[model samples]
Target: MIWDNNFAVSIFPILLQGLWVTVQITLLGTLLAAVLGLVFAVLRRLAIPVLSQVVSFLVVFVRGTPLLVQAYVAFFVLPAYGVSFNALTTGIVVIGVNYSAYMAEVYRSGIQGVPKGQWEAATALSLPGVRTWGRIILPQAIRTVVPMLGNYLIQMFKDSAVLSAITVVELMATAQAIGSSSFRYIEPLTLAALLFLAVSYPASRLVNRLERRYAPQH
Candidate 1:
């Protein structure tokens, strides 16, 4: 009764469009995180002089800071320095960079878990360094970490709500806009919750299934 039927109906389409933007940000951000994370993981394993140390410091800094602050810095503060980006791009970069640090740790553990014997075998066979990693080490490490990476993807999806703070007009932002304009919080906020649950729940189940399927076979 607080919102007229017409207003509620009209807002649904707007929210759905906003949801599409959220999905796009999550997908692109996850892709970037996955690639950057793997690169960092491999670099950490290589322990290449100062580059490894710098990357290690960066990973710690990103993982330590709050993501909302990062979003604000990327969207608001960067613009003052003549580094302007649209809301969606800012959201993607912030989330991707933040999660990449966490994913890098997950990947590092996976790579380290590979038996030393495997590396020794590659060396004994006179395999080139790149071929050894690409053919032997990376495949096993990736299988171990895929589930964790998928979980990070889900986490990024949920965290996309934070982008609302930067005026990204994602699902939560759209909900807030509709609620503020119409003075009805229940329907729009409730709908956003349901939409997030609908996506996240299934994605989580898929992650579990992947973990079970790809788990180390002893």
Candidate 2:
């Protein structure tokens, strides 16, 4: 038969195993991106003459480069300098750092969205710099940031497929391996695409809901 039901059924479990790895990469990468992005945003927001300029340039550089090249450097070149990690670890870190540049911009916008009155209030009360940001600025800023972060999470989930090139054995990689070994492409590839849609579609909807919920009132 052109499309073998039994073969597809047999490989479903294996594909799921790969899907789990993809999920792991997505979750860990998004977490890393969110934290690192905040750091980048804050550094820039501080507007320290040297530090802010350096951070801004680095963010721009990362945003300008292609993710595949970044992955290649991390997986292939870093080892010569003794900065090697396992394939999955390298993939997660590369993906996280790559997305961090974009997330930094998102965070900056959210931070800028905060009302000037809040800053004045903190200054008037003699709140420490750390406390002003930690208690007042970040909480209000993060409410706006949450929905954008969720959207990035979904994007990263889909982008995890690119890491398959580094031998991460994520869902796309698993499907490709199955196709190569069995010389059958349609079933596994189609199923993999379906699995991606299954997760991303719902996540997108949730992000929309969050955006509406957190949207600033006019």
Best by lDDT: 2
Query: In candidate 1, what are the lDDT values of residues 1-218, reduced to their tens digit?
Result: 65466766767888888889889989999999999999998898899999999999999999999999999889879999999988888889999999999989998988888999999999999999999999999999888988888898889889999999999989999999988987888889888898899899999999999999989764
Cα lDDT tens digits for candidate 2, 9-112: 99999999999999999999999999999999999999999999999999999999988889999999999999988999999999999999999999999889
Q: Whole-model lDDT for model 2 versus the true structure?
A: 0.94
Whole-model Cα lDDT of every candidate shown, in order: 0.90, 0.94
Collision pairs in model 1: none
Lowest summed lDDT window (length 10), candidate 1: 1-10
Q: Report the C-alpha displacement of residue 125, candidate 2, in angstroms.
A: 0.9
Q: Candidate 1 deviates by what RMSD? A: 1.6
Report the Cα lDDT for residue 58, model 1: 96
How does each model score on TM-score? 0.94, 0.97
